[model samples]
Target: MTEWWLWMYVAAMAGGVVLFTRWRADPCGVPLSEYRVAIAIPLWSGFWYLVMALGGGRAEVAGHTLYWARYADWVVTSPLLLVALTLTATHSLPGRRWGLMSTLVGANVVVILGGLAAELTADATARYTLYAIGVLALLAVYGLIWGPLRAHAHRQPKEIAAVYREAALLLSVLWVGYPLFWLIGPAGAGLISSATTSLLFVLLSILTKVGWSIVDLGRLRSLSGRGRLTVV
Candidate 1:
């Protein structure tokens, strides 16, 4: 558990950096049609970092640390459901894409909150892990949806679709990879494996976020090339 927390922190930090850097670049700038979605990305990413800094889901001597941190972590990611729903509402995403994103986000949100409730009330390990696996599986599904979305967006120029797709893809892929570490690792890999895996997860997450930022920056540059516009 200690090792797991460490790795989780690393992953969270990486994801946060990627998000913050992109925010710094102001790719979407202060306002736009998708301002909520744009702002929410970094906000959620920062919460992820807060979760790690707070030491999520670990058994401290007082247990309060993990208790509070875990809830914070859940809350941090919960906006994903809202974002997914809003995106689908736009009707810009295809049927399959919308359905998959909605299902993944909806299901994960339910399971996560339920698991947290169960943890607080009953302290069930199996339930938590099972729900976690489900979350991981959903993330993988997200990756599949994102790939097609990315392709679809790239087909059109000067649309926010491509940038959104890139961000979504990066986030989904990193999460998918993080869960795979737990499912595929050896039975008794112990601290070393857990810590190493956790670190790698963080690194990948960070890289993915950063990658999204780069794409957004490129898009901004392209947008700027059209004309010099100052913020109002």
Candidate 2:
């Protein structure tokens, strides 16, 4: 399918980013905690992008159409993305916050997987129910960010706290696109073609995965190289 070819290019770009991040990580001279998680996100993402390109699935219902091997990709990559975000944002969170973060990450998974389920189904009632549940789970994720997570980030060393705050903002804004595109893109209302969906997806990945990694690398460098970074 032509869609497959288009995604192949996207996957190549993702793969290139993975390599570039890795190369950039070591030079930063700090044990950037973000890299381990960041690398896995794109590594898995690129794999699924390639898989979807070559062997993707399709569904159409109520005028909504989807090339949905991308959902399967999200099933794995989405969780990893949050994992990186939580760990980066909570760089200095206490032991208890770890448990809270885990619960939030679990909720995030349900949200993405539930969305995937919504896409795969053709029943209007069932689809909307799944979407509603997914939305609720995603809200729980936002709730945690503003709740316990925010408290911890605020308590961290001021400069480090600033980095965490910026990372949290990026996570919040970039991830909101998932549901937005889902509603308007090929998979939900057919307002956009699958190519347009893939392009948007590509740009989002660049902004989130690649962009976040660069931010993390810079923060780590600040912490480890210049000695200006602080943690408490």
Candidate 3:
């Protein structure tokens, strides 16, 4: 069942790559950078999933089996996802925007690393400490997304602002599932079986990566069709 979920993730990510490729072909005024980032997210994620499906990227840590590759995948792709979303909110890169983006990405890195460390730690207190750090970093990520980022999106034309809102909201909501699952799954309290956790993670990954990208790029395409999107 766990293997099935891993392969399913691989398939979902492959589908994401194909879908994003088709979207990229449209010469809409949407910035090419967005397309590039969107494509890279799933492409990298698919690679890691494929690796895991092939029985790679797993480890026995603290008497629990851990797929560290998932953390490896998240460490890279989450930053890229934030980059894509931040670009959507701030159409043109300004000095201040760069700072915000940097902090957002940095916070995300800490979150991933903290989770990985927590998973590897055998000591309960240390494990929870690492998890706390991760949760704090996640809160920082949320604050930036909903605060300055959302404010910047509101400054754009209504169509563009609408796209950012939908994309940001989708991301914010879907991301909460990760920590929740981690808390209940093998990584924390072990309230659920590993197979169930694997299935849940697979579903969440598909939604947050492929699902969010579709909504984002699709809305941008719609704006382009109506001549509402302009390349800056």
Candidate 4:
């Protein structure tokens, strides 16, 4: 299963590409039209991760392995992920442009990168500490999701509120596992196999990315007064 991670990368890129392509084909020109880059970044970065992995891009230092491509992928995709979420959440808001997304999403990036470094560190204490920090960051993220974000959603219509709530819940659930995943990776104490870790990564990305996009798609339907689509 040495290439299991690579396969996951390939599959995610392929699927995301197809999904985004269909989204482009659709003719929703008002606001769903504006999020092309938000939805597109992850798909693009997913391909880069696959390419870098297949091209044998990896580094090992002090008993720790790093996938440079994955890091690069995160550099672009993480920001876009937050943007996508922020934009989706703000969709129902009256005149809020960025909403709490800038603050919370910036913090999320720091937490995630810090957690990655913690996993690569050899000191158990530091790793645990960093994991704790990541957890706290997520807690704050949840607070914003349920607190300010929810409040904004509540100010909107019922269907809009439903979209924001579902998106937030899905994001929270999917992200809650990331720190754990970091722990179980080549750096973590959980010591899962590479194949298992790769599979988990696939599951996380697919569920979170597609799940968020689908919720937003439903919101699109609500705004456009259309029906639900099996795929967005």
Candidate 5:
């Protein structure tokens, strides 16, 4: 990984943390969509920590970066997959959130294990290729399945719609960027393009989540006003 980009990625990661803090502090003003999508923070947080701890400080990695990078797939995927699945299980979801969630989780697991095997077996191409495909598939399914629930949530108000839309677009950004950085950016682009991509992901995570929190807050306020929130 190029040294310059590595610092850039670090800066971006820092920005994300800042945004998450803002969102958490002002949840009432943020959108509900945030509560779910914000899961990305934890994923990235774990990843960044892994890279630093195992890959020799922020600026350098003494050995094969792949060794540390490989752990990222499992570390980021496992917990996030669980969160996505849990959110989908809600009765409030219009369709089978679990089914779609399962698909996404299953795909990640497959890619993680496949990548591990490929790496262990000395098949770099196979490992990265599987990871790329799995991520793309996961993104597509996430958009399709979660899109509707978000839409319904948006239908309640213009502000709500704005929140959901922002969240969707943010998700899209991640879907697009993560793969590009991995597939096209130089090896350990995690280090090379660290600042740019990390910043992008973090900012998107925060802004979209802000929108999400706002929508949810608005909805709750409205329900309370109508005495509907307590009906159930």
Candidate 6:
């Protein structure tokens, strides 16, 4: 069952790669950077899923089978997703854009790394301590997204502002599921089987990476067609 879900994840990501590549043909004045990030997210994730499906990306950590490759994938792709979303809001504010993006990405790195460490730690106190750190970092991510990022997005043309809001909201909601699943799954407690955890992660990844990218790029295309969006 776990193997089946991993294959499903690989297929989903492959579809994302193909879809984004075809969309790249005519960006309709939308920046190619956005397409590049969108495509990269799925491309990298597909490769990692392929590795896991082949039984090459797991290890016994703290008596639990840990798919560290998932963390490896998230460490890179999550930041890229944030960069894609951040670009939409900060494209018009070049002076402080990179600074804000760097801070957000840095916080995201901590979130992933903390989770990884927690999974590897056997001590209950240490594991929960790491988990708490990750949760805190996630809150920091939300703060940046809702506070400063939303402020910048609102200052954009209404169409672009709307696009940013939708993307941000989708990501914010989907991301909360990761820690919840982690807390209840084999990693944190023995409440759920590994296969079930794999299935849930597969669904979440598809939505967060492929589904979100489709909505983001599609909306950008619509904005471009109406002359409300331009290459930054």
Best by lDDT: 6
C-alpha lDDT values of all predictions = 0.47, 0.70, 0.89, 0.66, 0.45, 0.90
Predicted candidate 3 versus true structure: per-residue lDDT over 118-209, tens digit per residue? 99999999999999999999999999999989999888888888889889989989999999999999989999988789889999999999
Residue range 1-232, candidate 1, lDDT tens digits: 3445444554554554555456556643423433345445545554655555555544433122223343454444544533432342232333335554565566556545644443343233664565465565565556545554455544444354544565565555555553355344321122335346546645554454334444544554455556532223
Instruction: Work out the TM-score per prediction.
Output: 0.50, 0.83, 0.96, 0.83, 0.50, 0.96
Kindly give the stretch of ten consecutive residues in candidate 3 with the minimal lDDT sum: 90-99
Name the runs in model 4 displaced over 4 angstroms.
1-5, 226-232
Going through the candidates in order, what is the number of backbone clashes in each? Answer: 2, 0, 0, 1, 18, 0
Tens digits of lDDT, candidate 5, 79-163:
3633433342232334435565566566556545544443343345665666666566556556653665464544444543443
Off by over 4 Å in 2: 4-29, 55-66, 93-96, 230-232
Q: Give the TM-score of candidate 6.
A: 0.96
Candidate 5 deviant stretches above 4 angstroms = 1-26, 29-64, 67-70, 73-99, 111-121, 124-136, 139-158, 185-232
> In candidate 2, what residue range of length 10 has the lowest lDDT sum?
24-33
Pairs that clash in candidate 1: 11-202, 14-206
- Candidate 6 residues 122-199, lDDT tens each? 999999999999999999999999999999988878888999999999999999999999999998877999888988
Better of 1 and 6 by lDDT: 6
**lDDT per residue as tens, model 4, 119-159:** 56778898788778877877877787788777766766666
